[model samples]
Target: MTTVTKNKVTDLFLENAPSFGSFLSLREESKQIVNEKGLPAAKDEEYKFTSVSKKLEQVITDFSTAKPIAVSKDTIKDHLWAGFEGSYLVFNNGIFSKELSAFENSGFGVQMLSESNAIALGSIAKAEKDPFIALNTIYFEDGIQISIPRGKKVDSPILFLFFNQANEGQIISPRILIEVAENAEATFLEHSISLDEAVYFSNSVTEIKVGQNSHVHYSRLQNDGSKAIVVSNFETDIHRDATFTSTVVSLSGDLVRNNLSLRLQDSGCVGNMYGLYLLNGKTHVDNHTNVDHTKPHAESNELYKGILTDQSRGVFNGKIFVRQDAQKTNAFQQNNNILLSEDAIVNTKPQLEIWADDVKCSHGCTTGQLDEEALFYLQARGIDKMQAKGLLLYAFAGEVLEHINDESFRNYIDGLVQERLGSNF
Candidate 1:
């Protein structure tokens, strides 16, 4: 009988040897931590919501270094970045492609980082254990670093473009780190688009640290192919009196998982998180968010909604933790979903763990089908059954979409939802 050995994450690290040699001195330490502790199993309290064991098992077979992949601007303009203005940073196969990017260095302090300069920042270490992040740090050839001078307000939105070409059976990992100076304000838009029909995997991580009293707005649009699989993690650190808001929209993917963590480290900080996911076919989408309030008077609000049709599945796990010293903290979370087909499945969990008794915290979740009365009322108003259903679904999602502060972006998302619903409107 022949035996097949499953590839372990350790194997990927070993084969890539030199790429990860940067951590060689600590390889033994990391290996011990990973192999012995490894990634938490499905039972791990932190990862209990999403099962990554089977997914992690799909490690690289040979583990060779990645070569630069060429991309063209004309191709990007024709396929992605169709409608948008401002700066664009394009990356392919986890390597930044400068030719495909455009920038206006008009005094906002936005510039690409020289390799040496990025290394000096010393912030990348926070993402070391993230497998994809490790891969990017080791293999990533180049990436853009946007630095807003202290107190500079970036009026134009900065867009990060990750394009996955038609590379069948290949995996890509992209890494990004943003630093916002005190009292700085900026908006970031990241989108992944591809024209290929192959089943590619995009594993990426983004870390943002908001300086004291700074404001950062981040939005991610995941519009990969239905056959594509993606895993993304975003972590942000908010300082005193800073505002950090993020919204994620997942349109398509075979299996998509997004993990977002926000650490409110100082008092008077505000954290806001919102997500919308639509799943169909056999696609599975999971959105998990964690908010930690470590100081007094911090506030956090989270709301997520999902729509599952066909035989697809959706999951949402939102958690809030208030430390013992985090008195007067206000935290609220809610997750709602609608299942269109009997075969569709939706799992939603909203949790709050508070150690301070003087805090006001609340969490609630609901999963159910469409309102029959609302549908009947629309139908009675002369709307066709399918059209009526689409309208109701749009209205249900509009409440969440309305929270989006940007009107143009909200309209763009509304158009996407309308097209997905197949409503003539």
Candidate 2:
């Protein structure tokens, strides 16, 4: 891993890096914030369990000199989700692939961030405390933006496919924005994949705003290559009587970290966040989530589960905040993990801060191995130990998978989980 410091970041990256088109002109305020807050060191409380500072130097040294991956149209068509039933928008190497994309959102509007679009937007994200968001603001110029009209409901879900390929140590930035108008409803399925195995980095950001009385379902499934390093931030804003649901699944990566934040600013708003990870080999995954209840009568629920095999490691941090004005707030959080190997490691922390006397809030975490008694019972039933362990692990992770309302999508994810268990366990 490369060593990260204030001097190295300035001398090696900012000083000699090429410009990022029109985005550079709109990054004054964010640059100031990045300079002031800086990147979180290993000693920082927020990033203690995950060695983010140690891994930072590897991602930025050659990031400014990366060239676009050489890919043909046939390569993109061969690697897509076949049964989505909805039109797809493809981003090839972090740039919108207009020629290879289908153009139907089932009454929703789609806008790619052009120069004019970039000029119209004010601020891209609310992650002021994070330095990766600042890096994205400085280098990203294109992404997807979707808007649903008031009271309009789309039956078919929209697909957002991000294909990142860098064979010679490159970096890519992918961004997305979605807004569901008042009383409208929409669903988005996002897939992140790495096309090449060589060392590379992908920094992605997604912002979602749900209007009053609207609902939005956002799912992110990541299965990158072995040499891929990923950092993504997912932020959500919920209004009165609205609902926001997020499902994050991590199946494969060399190193992956996710920072998710949500704010409930009005009464009757509902926020649900769920995460599931299956790690093997030397893969590492870290998930940090924050939910803020700023208004009365708001509710938030969170659950994250992980299965680590071989020498893999996993970390989870969940925080819930109920303000003084958030009377009658209901917040619950839980984190659980199963370690299959003696060398596998897991760190889980669930925290809650509530100021309102009338609110109900709770948090709990557990990290342990599977039950030997159950394995013995399955062995007596003529089942092999490996198959029996896979079965038990699948059943352990099914609780969060049950929340996926889309049956076909749920079944697809079930297949991935089964394959991982059979091979890793």
Model 1 agreement with the true structure over 1-425: per-residue lDDT tens digits: 23222235544544454334343433344343443444445666655655554554562333443444667767777744335667778887666776777776744544444443554232533435454444444444445566777988887787788877535345576767688889989888877886676666576767788889998888777888877777887888899999999888888887788889899999999999988887788788888788999999999989898888898888888889999999999999999899888999987778888899899999998999999999999899899889888888888787777766555566777788889877322
Can you give the lDDT of residue 224 in candidate 2? 90
Candidates' TM-scores? 0.88, 0.93
Task: Name the weakest run of 10 consecutive residues (lDDT summed) in model 2.
Answer: 115-124
Q: What lDDT is obtained when candidate 1 is compared to the true structure?
A: 0.73
Q: Give the whole-model CA lDDT for all candidates, comma-separated.
A: 0.73, 0.79
Could you give candidate 2's per-residue lDDT for residues 1-425 as a string of tens digits? 24344534533434444465555555655565556665666777888877654675755456553445655667656755556676667877777776777765479887776633633243436547577777666666577777789999888777777778765556677777777789998888878777767677787887888999998888778899987888898888899999998888899888898999999989999999999999999999999999999999999999999999899999999999999999999998999999989999999888888889998888898998998999999999999999989889999899888877556667778888898888757
The most accurate candidate by TM-score is 2
Question: Candidate 2: which stretches are off by over 4 Å?
Answer: 1-7, 16-25, 59-61, 65-67, 70-73, 115-124
On lDDT, the leading prediction is: 2
Candidate 2 backbone collisions, by pair? none
Predicted structure 1, TM vs. truth: 0.88
